[model samples]
Target: MKTLLLALLLLPIAAIGDDSRQLVKLPPAAQESLRQEMLDNLVAVNEVLTLMAEGKVKEAGEAAETKLGMAAMGKHRGKPVDARPGPHMPPAMHGIGMDGHRAVSEFAAVAKTGDRDKALALLPNLTSACVGCHFSYRTR
Candidate 1:
């Protein structure tokens, strides 16, 4: 009885772990578009990181703002391509969309006020969202 109870308890944890793993099933065109968007964001984020490391906070903030804006607009194709119904859309993609919007909004607020310190502080959250998205959904 104890062993069975323990197995039952662990089963939910295992299921939750599986739930967090994303398996994206994007069409070829959608895959290409997402790849391009990731590349663009990577470049922009890299530039901002470089600038920030050099203590060019203002320039970094500006670049960050641009990157964030691009993310917000989903500039690759201006929106998520319509995926076929069912498990076509991964959980990570949904997480990315939500987190990306939050990160971008935070960066925008800091950029508008020219708050370099705040912007710099907020950079990690933005980068986290990007990294999180990439880890889950990348074209093979």
Candidate 2:
């Protein structure tokens, strides 16, 4: 029974290893779209970091919210943008839908009043949701 249980657990691990070995095959257009999405998201996130560092927290929060919303909708150039696998994936971009919505809402509350400190304080929590999502899901 113990051996059977151990085998059952190891079976999924072996399957996952095999899956990882399989090359990720995407069409050229899809690959380009994925690359662009990653670049755009990185730019947006970097901008937010800059704003925060400059103590322009309100602006940062607003920009973050806007970028996050765009990411969540997955609409780039009138087409859908999907998440990319591996390091190309931005943690923040992975959190779409409800998670993104909540983060934006929180950021907005602090941003509306142009409160730099408050906005800065909210940034980590917002970023954390993104991190959580990325850790939980795998992109194709």
Candidate 3:
């Protein structure tokens, strides 16, 4: 009985981190597009990390800048959310997106300077922004 009660109490906590299509409530096409964008971003991040691992710091930084920086926003503009028939993102969600890009841009700048230690340290903070957003928002 004690263990069962404990499990029940922790259930919502577990679900909090597993939020899915419940928060954003977008159309199917828009949701899929968003998911695809997320996958693409993940791929870009992986490529940047690979380059960094190979000691190609400049190239890695360039990759991060091109893939996740301000330049990348142009490609996403009017495509992911604006031109697509969907509701506007809540301000909190919008802020999360901007914050994430800023973190990546800062990381790219650090990597560009060949400061491996500082760049690596920043990666965790960038990742934390991603995880926090995931935990706090979801799209259907």
Candidate that scores best on TM-score: 3
How many steric overlaps are in each model, in order?
Answer: 0, 0, 1
Please say which candidate is ahead in lDDT: 2 or 3: 3
Report the C-alpha lDDT of model 1 over 28-80, residue by residue, as the tens digit: 76666666766877898788778768877677666766766534464543444
Clashing pairs in 3: 24-138
| Index of the highest-lDDT prediction | 3
> How many residue pairs in model 1 have overlapping backbones?
0
**Once model 2 is optimally superposed onto the true structure by TM-score, how far is the C-alpha of residue 92 displaced, in angstroms?**
16
Q: Which segments of model 1 are wrong by more than 4 Å?
A: 1-20, 70-72, 76-88, 135-140
TM of each candidate vs. truth: 0.63, 0.56, 0.75
lDDT of 3 by residue, 1-140 (tens): 23223333444664655443236776676667677778888998789879978988878778888888655664545675543422466765666666667767888898889888888887653454466566556663
Clashing pairs in 2: none
Candidate lDDT scores, in order, read 0.59, 0.55, 0.67
Candidate 2, residues 1-140, lDDT tens digits: the string is 23223333444554553343223445556667766755776787788889888878777767877775433443544654433232234433333334655666677668657887777777764455444343333346
TM-score of 1: 0.63
Candidate order (TM-score): 3, 1, 2
RMSD of each: 8.8, 9.6, 7.9
